[model samples]
Target: MSTIAPARVVLEAAGIRKQFPGVVALDDVSLRLRSGEIQALVGENGAGKSTLIKILTGVYQPDAGSVTIDGAPVRFGSARDALKAGISVVHQEHNLIPQFTVAENILLERIPTRLPQLVDYAAIYREARPWMKTVGLDMPATRSVSALSAAQMQLVEIAKALSLQARILLLDEPTAAITPHETGYLFRVLRELRAQGVAVVFVSHKLEEVFELADRVTVLRDGRNTALDHEIKGLTQDQMVTYMIGRSDVLAQLPARPARGEPVLEVRDLATEAGARGITFSLHRGEILGLYGLVGAGRTELAKAIIGELKVTGGDVLVRGRSARIRDLRDALARHRIGYVSENRKEEGLILLHSVLTNMSITIWRRLRLFGQWIRRSSETAAVMPLVKQLDVRAHSLAQQVGTLSGGNQQKVSLGKWLAADVEILIIDEPTIGIDIKTKNALHELIWNLAANGKAIMVISSDMPEIVRLADRILIMRNHRLVGDISNSHDYEEVSAAIMSRLS
Candidate 1:
């Protein structure tokens, strides 16, 4: 008699289907993750990747279908319940409390206490040391989370997950905020975890990293599995790209940078109270100037100071060769014709529950008011539609909630608002973040088109290839100071080497 082999799958979602009023978020989607393997979950925004992950991690209950662990069906009523089932997640967003110590945050549920119910501070630190060491995260357990950088906070999240003694791990955009050096260390940790037979589900928009780390891949599109559990060997990135986007015609080539015109904006001795110091750069019309740096290098702080989000301790921001005093964001946008798209798009960029029409038109509302204190909805719709269409935002209608759209589409919506305002100088921070290859190409084309039209554009990105691909000139920032500048000739290798040299 022949015996059947037992299933090695550690975590799986079988035939998942989810619905939210008008949207079918997931339709018969299936994913299987085995022990000792890293399975990549990839798709365009709104392709149902997040929804499926939430189901596996117990954040959302699937309308239909079941989740299984080790061939045993399980129902998770809460995130805590999933944790108890040996599944843990490291979210893209930091979930730790700012006021709490790293150890307290990591061991919140299982803190050791004395007879008087007083927290055992010494034990708390010791409990977290092993997990932290596993990931090469060096930090005092007593340090406040607010004191840590974005990359350090991410490492804490990973350590916290490991503290749960999880066999199945889900990491969402884990490297989104980390530096390349830190990412290399993180990859080593993950490889070690895999060798120890831990199953991992990795989700990210950075295709290069996915290709480098994933042993197998799964592609989702429109809530269904288009490419389920595909092995990495013999599969080209081009083939995988086609699977997620569902078309080969999507533009991949970025246009050449337009000829540099006279300076549209100049920052002289720019210093912000938040730590950006002595930043000096002149952005010319028809030029896409990129700012590249590691996380917490004062890049975002510099942008904030220029746009008046952060109080400028000292500096002269000149517009068209003339000093323009930006009192606030409104002054920057309305008076100086400058606009900024923040890095934290979900929180600072859009009011998620609002409609797409509202999100795109919000910035231009001062102009949208027909009569005193009266705004015409039709006029608002008409004003933003052309730009929305230009960005190719996929939505059910103009009235559809912005939060319900895919990541790529939502980013377009965020960009659309600035376009609607018709700003002279636009600063976009990590525009293609969480965006697929096709959508990224479309965004690149739109960016170049704007610069080519004589609108000065400044792109701030942590991505080397992205900056190298798009920038005519790249500026490097380190420790709140301008360190180096390199003109791009589209030679990614040489440009990246030059960047690392300065950073090192």
Candidate 2:
């Protein structure tokens, strides 16, 4: 562990209170961040963690409160103003323009110039190289931003913030999509930044990383401060979860059971145009069959191909022992009672600019027709609202845009959409990615309940614990082929070792 000494407060939010249409996002909350410290903010979905970050980063103005830096109160009208005040945020979504070069994106605001305000390309690259080196981003400055990987884009975001001379940095779910190897590199950079007296405010759902990297933690629950500011020393993950969810009891766990009856779905010799080759699997009714693999191991591609998103070159999909040919996503959903939930929810799984009700009712409109042609709004709401409530989605109303909701809540909506459509065979990929522990448990329970009600669930995930806890049977894929298949007896180490052996 790195040695550190307590320092003065660099930032503070006092008596914060923010209210939305029908919810109190923050209620008299307070938080303090010290210089040269990593302050982790943790909470369940819709606990007002995002609201607080928005208020601090100038995305939204607080209804009541004061934000101070170095004992001086300041008001920022916009994100640019906040950046000028030495506050910069690295959001989950990349903010850089994809068409721009790495150097151009890093120094976008203050590009170098020669006589007559001419854009100096050489000077821009030279200025961007130092910040990139400082953040340990080892990519060519002339490369396009779109060509970089997720981890590379994250590092570029940090470089851009450093180029702005940011004293206080705010990061939201920085490791959600990246691999563990990339996460190690990110932590190494954070440690170097911490030693340089920078104040980092990290907001993430991963509690293990929070405990490992943060010096102090602030826990929020139901729009109020449970632990406003507490040191991480002597704190356990279980204790932290208790503060966030107001419960110390163990989460409800499902017992293993054998799935009976005929298989709901059977894929034989599946071949997808998206690099999947010779994939074969069978999912029985009321079974939670899990596909476990590393990232880019053809798990998602196989799911998409089965759902008709990608073209299938050679394979057969049998639904309830009958061969089925799908035309597209709509045909797959309507003709066959098959639904697919994407792992990348923001881009593929959701329409972020629309209302939550609208996104959920996307597939329901065709189902709730008055004369088999027209959709009745009343009937649609009556059918979807129950599933929303059953899923425990925290929102002011159905009219709220899903983009404003937390990541976990948005995931709930994505799952609920399929449930609303009454799909018997459901395929959910990465259901608990970037979700808090409490929410993760709730989702697992929901999945278990769905399966108990006779819905065949096929889960594709890279999370080993999720697979071990939720699946009855596990299949491992390595280099686009099924390498191993085994029963999960609630033993994590055994399944993990078996999967690794197959991969090796």
Candidate 3:
């Protein structure tokens, strides 16, 4: 009898150790990738998943350990070196130049040249076409990337990485912004690449995706490897969560609570310039209202309209039964005590270049002024410290740059600023996007506590289980219109069915 031979190892990192000022980012971590296999690198936030990816892609150097390609030891001095060594990565954040055309960005690393060092525009578009089609991006290659939505931008990033045609591809939360249909297409493409003997490293917070796509799994926790290169077959999601978080009960469902008392926010026949039309809803004090929709369903735009970021073309907004003339975000926060936690947290929620303290205290800087004059740094620190502890944010100190923290910690700071301002009505968009299961549970519990404390919360999420778990009522939107408002029964099947029915 003849048997098929095993695939060869494409890349391996063994005994990796990395450290920062006050944190050991990675310690004795190891990862192995085989050709013709999709390997999942998973862990909770701060578990060294991002740190490992950076080290593998040459964004950071490891203090210890070695990397090997095809049984040959190699060292990558920079990202370019890694790419030259047949490695490419699509990070969690968008790396495309917004003003550039899609074709230009996709072929950025290897723009074709003509005679006399001249740029070749025709060659750029022609070379980018196949990659765009491979990722199922239907837009024209000449379109400006800035005009694309977040989901479309994510697709462009994937296309750009695929254009490299690297032997090893690393993807970090690649499906975080795209719709289910787009995710299905990407999965098909990844499978094709695996069949072509390309090694893939997929990093995501979604467990189902991992099980569906990966051939092997590597689990990390506290910068250490808990499981390395375990076959995906016969592995359960519960086991995976335990490996990541050291506990399987982190996703316990929140208790259902019905809304009561007077409406805190009332939107009547609201129409916005962003395409939301005739939307009407009432949010009561201590109520958790969910906004559910697919990508480009106008969920985020509706939240922006409520907070005055988008122009209201028609209808009225009432707070506490009184007409609210919210002119802008400042008016929404200061005059009306309405706050929004944007879905695009990296760009819209927190200032990455600023310190954690600065980002967390920005919302209340005006309120913290002494005698309506200058604000004291000591006072700012005092105000944000409690929230840092409350949110269990993992950072060296308040002075650390917000950009340096993990995705989950950044999200905490994003929501922490609004909590510091003590906003009565809060709009949180995609609260758990790209975050780990443990941090997600913590945030969900925090949201529940906030609502219990008489704060009305509007949660916009594509996560069906999250919506079913937290929201007292759900408003379904499709094609920029609200189609259904159903009381959440906290049953996943029932809630998901109701939501899909409305979406259809």
In angstroms, give how far residue 277 of model 1 lies from its true place: 5.3
lDDT of each: 0.87, 0.88, 0.89
1 or 2, greater by lDDT: 2
Write one digit per residue (lDDT tens) for candidate 1, span 245-359.
8776564547565578999999998888988778888999999999999877988888988988888888888999899878878889888889999888899999999999999
Please give me the total number of clashing residue pairs in predicted model 3: 0
Against the hidden true structure, what lDDT does model 3 obtain? 0.89
User: Would you give me the overall lDDT of model 1?
Assistant: 0.87
- TM-score per prediction, in order, is 0.87, 0.90, 0.90
Total backbone clashes of candidate 2, pairs 3 or more residues apart or in separate chains: 0
lDDT per residue for candidate 3 within 106-217, as digits (tens), equals: 9998899997689999999999999898767888999999999766787787778777878899999888878887788778878877887788899988998999889889
Worst 10 residues of 1 by lDDT: 1-10
